[model samples]
Target: MSTLTDRLIYIVGPLKLQNALMASFLERETGAKCLAVEKFHDIQNMDNENTGQPKLALWDCLGNDMESCLSEFEPDFKEVLNHSAVAFFNVSPDLGIEAEFIARGVQGFFYEHDRIERFPQGICAIFNGELWFSRKIMNEAMKKDKKQTGLQTRYETDLSHREIEILAMIAGGASNKMIAEKLYISPHTVKTHLYNIFKKINVTNRLQAALWAAKNLS
Candidate 1:
């Protein structure tokens, strides 16, 4: 396995708003176990003397009083950021405000006003090594160059048809080879598809993915 797969991800911000949402989403949505610290210094201090470091640190970029927070946090911020892939969340509009955070240290910025649907999409994108910007902002950036795009419906990105079938087979006690034969594909293909399905549904194993499919999709 790669070091990234073994590494944890940390989220730092206020307890109630920015940090909690990301912490909950990461724990449930990704394979990594995430640790959340309220302060940047606490996270840096913990990592310095620890056995290993987190894969990434997602900081709430623009907090109460940006100038004051930056002046107070510059030192610890640089240290924590140096260890992990740093991402920022603005949560409010005003691209200028988000830009300021990006300039400070964040590699990516997520809008706070996006529907909860986009939050996971953004995190997953960042986890895979890409920047997640507000499609709203993107729309503005590309407006003159592009044509109209259809708005994505809520259920559109949920699951694939084959994934649903595999999940059902899993719930029905079908082994990988059995699923392979049933689907007229090789066992290797079945395993690969299963892994992708698990990633989509945010589960690590067949049973959990199956249960989620049964309860939510079926």
Candidate 2:
């Protein structure tokens, strides 16, 4: 897991704008091969193949397609996902989402915007299996909308303000239960709200829903 040499960092997500700038920055900086797939379905399908999972797989929790890829498969990547070192990044990930992912198995979690300048360095550090956020000072970042675009803009003309709010929270890494609690509404309302967000975002699951926002929101 010494990431000093050229190695693959399996990338997934909408590969949205927030991190793309940083991803490119890292690619140029690290001399690494960042392999990406539109969805993790390809890897899931090739689960039995001998491609050998990378020494490090950098994933975004916001991909709904990956969620489906996970749900639909039995020998889920979760089994082999951590056989090697794993580092996770979230564009607007909050505690709840980060906790969920940690439960699923991740050594670290980072926010895209905050780490923009540090991604290149961070990935190498994380690849070594260190639980990285910071040695001191754990962090999180949330910005009010100033017309920033990730996957959210894809729905700008289609979604309502309430739906937009729910999407923001979801993208920021809130669960349906947490979203309901935060929005002061019933879980049923949260589901309804999320359903609308999903439709507008054109994704089937929350991860994808979040990824949509991550890629387009800003």
Candidate 3:
């Protein structure tokens, strides 16, 4: 698999020195070339026609008005989402922008106070085509999913007790490995149970299953 350093990275924010330092650190840590731009318009003016590789954009939201910054960059955000992936750094837990960004296809989010050492791991996960949100954000998403699916009753769906237990864990933002460990089951067994759970509940992904659990199990 290609590492994150193999791709171009753009750090978007208003702080020039801080952004430059961040870019330097990322390059030193990952051996990846990075560009620090103060405005989205700078990115728009760059020539990227030669490299067809998907780029990564990290929006630094520390010490600024999150809502105002996001609103100002909404057009640029959409443009970046068209051909590349976007992630947020220095985010607050209660910023309440996760859902909107998720809806806009954001790939990752890191809390403002999170350790900088985890940046490489998060970036790698995003490069590997996975969502890298904080556990709090995931739990909030689960709650939202659950509330949206709350009209359905348990009696309406004949899910087994084990299935319900697993679904509840899923809604709580537990990974398959975590669930398997907690439930004293093999990962394979968890997968099987999830498949059955999805089929029974007529849902496809973890988000949907979480919603189903919220509606019926809660």
Candidate 4:
């Protein structure tokens, strides 16, 4: 089992010195290995071995406005996001895009004026499988969801019985390993089923798939 102490963290930003400083501070506070990367693409090269370990990436907003920050992610953010849980830091207040970030599978937000001491606590919480969202962000995400009473007809017709079972397990917050153990299969097979489920449902990420199941599945 992965514990908080053995997790990995990436502090990705444009400023090398600042990133290094923050990484050092976090390593001291959290007792986890921290790496500072100046370029986002550089992360793909550095860590290739620990696929099963829980990792978090802290992306710097770099004082850009919300729209520009989002546009910066257009190139290859999805691939990065799939590998590690991501949180945005140095964000300005009242961006009104928190809900959008949630839709895109962002796990947390750190505002520009937020206290520096809070970083370690938030990072540790996220590392321990918790979403480090603010109450306002949580409320915004909730308000954006559309409530449904039962499963949708198209989903019932399109998804196979096994696919539906896996989807339900996903919606119930089961991880791949847990699902695999429950269903007498390997984690790779569970991943294969999830990939097919994403394609059939037209969703890009796990959060979207879970939300789809929530709104359309009973």
Q: Give the root-mean-square deviation of each candidate in angstroms.
A: 13.6, 15.5, 5.8, 6.2
Each candidate's TM vs. the true structure?
Answer: 0.51, 0.45, 0.63, 0.67
Residues 1-218 of candidate 4: C-alpha lDDT, one tens digit per residue: 22357788989888889888898888887888898886567667766866776788899986677678777766667777777888889877766667777777887788888888889878866664446665556545645765322334545447888888988876666667778999999978888998899999998666677667766775
Q: lDDT score of model 3?
A: 0.72
**Alpha-carbon lDDT, every model:** 0.59, 0.54, 0.72, 0.75
The true-versus-predicted C-alpha distance at residue 46 of model 3, in Å, is 2.5
Model 2, span 84-121: residue lDDT tens: 44556664543344433433445455674554655666
Error of 1 at 93 (Å): 1.1
- What residue pairs clash in candidate 4, if any at all? none
| Model 4 alpha-carbon drift over 4 Å, by segment | 1-3, 145-218
Per-residue CA lDDT of model 1 for 137-176, tens digit only, reads: 3333333222232332333346678877877776555667
- The most accurate candidate by TM-score is 4
TM-score of 4: 0.67
Model 4 gets an lDDT of: 0.75
Residue 213, candidate 1: C-alpha displacement in angstroms: 45
Clashes of 3: 0
